[model samples]
Target: MNTPPGLHLKIAEWMPENGEVVSAYDIAENFGITIRQSRAFLTILEKDNAIETRRGKVMPITCHNSHRRSTRTIKVISIDRDIIAQRRHHYNTYRHCPLKSINGLSRAEKWEFIIRNARRRKK
Candidate 1:
């Protein structure tokens, strides 16, 4: 399947590795893609280490194989302090940060940036 550009990143950022049980139908309905595409996306998520196994299952979905069934709602993962800090450290910027510009900045560099900004703000 020809995957869309940056689709994997979007999926990873949206879905937690060990959180939530989303149905394939839900994924398809929300992403406006087909069931086959949704299944493929799940595989891609796994490869990228995006989704983690929960109870020995990556994502246990209901009525995944049945398209005729009502689409299940997406489960929202409860964000804790660790996850928030992780997102901040890894992302190094806003969630929808364009080009992930700040991610590559080192800790020292980030400190310097903060100091520089603080100095500027003091003026």
Candidate 2:
């Protein structure tokens, strides 16, 4: 429904000026979303071409404060307006896509839906 676009815009607005790196954890912390959800949102933004990503070195929260953990994290680049416009138009015309299914669901419900769907697919 309105959540994804609204959230996309919110994330876009919250994005740092171009060239700064943002990890999924940064987004989770800023938006109160689960890390998994943040990652999923990042994936969606990437597909929309609203954000770009690259491997980066960073500290993981679970690690010791002094140690910067090396992992597979990729930093998300800033927002792209033109891509958002194009994606928005395409989504409007094709309402049966994945993003459309969780439209009216609350965050918790959305997670449930995601998990449930994943389980079904694994069957």
Candidate 3:
């Protein structure tokens, strides 16, 4: 199915910088859509060759107010390589992370490293 141009533009704007991952929950919340709709939209993006996605493990959470619980599976989406390279260049030039070898680190670990190093540099 073809996504509307306006919605597509909004989705693109809401996407994380290339190389960063975004969850379907994040997309749904940002776009004021249901989780299922977000997934469908992402699938369309993938079909259109606009993004790449990896299925992540499901997590369970319970609401504080309600007795109901739910499981949510996160889909990690990444933008094009060229865009990721450009973003990495920008990070390297301005927000340099001291870690010389980020080769094997997981995405969360890399983000932690960047945040920790950036915070240390500020002090």
Candidate 4:
């Protein structure tokens, strides 16, 4: 099934690695999608072997002053190998940020320095 771009990335980021249970409602609330959409997305993930699900007890939820309860089963999603590799590469690439050592500089001074250097690089 065709899914939205970055959906898998978002799911990978949100899901816990310890096999914690997550409900469709939780996914819907987190991603700002409808519960039906969340369920369908979970089904797609299941078909792709990205997640496992089990029937769970009813639970209550509150969002934006609204309250509701649901009996939807919880899905335990895992990060795919590609996503894990991407995360590792990103962390490695950005871990030692150059700006991190800008000691004794005020926030505005730091911003000025960054902007000045960035502009110089464009020449």
Q: Which stretches of candidate 3 lie over 4 Å from their true place?
A: 1-6, 18-20, 61-123
lDDT scores in order: 0.56, 0.64, 0.59, 0.64
Candidate 4 C-alpha lDDT tens digits along 44-98: 6656543444546656665555445543555544446775566656766756766
By TM-score, the candidates rank as 2, 4, 1, 3
Tens-digit per-residue lDDT, 16-114, candidate 2: 543456677778788888767777766665565566655566545675642445423455565677977787778777656554667888999999877
* Each candidate's clash count: 1, 1, 0, 0
- The number of residue pairs in model 1 that clash at the backbone is 1
lDDT of 3 by residue, 22-91 (tens): 5566777877787677767766655645456564555454547534354434333655757645654675
Residue 100 shift from truth in candidate 3, angstroms:
65
Model 2 superposed RMSD (Cα): 10.6
TM-score of each: 0.39, 0.49, 0.38, 0.43
- 3 or 4, which is superior by lDDT? 4
TM-score of 3: 0.38
Query: Largest TM-score belongs to which candidate?
Result: 2
- What TM-score would candidate 1 get against the native? 0.39
Give the Å error, residue 69, model 1: 11
Q: Which one is best on lDDT?
A: 2
TM-score of 2: 0.49
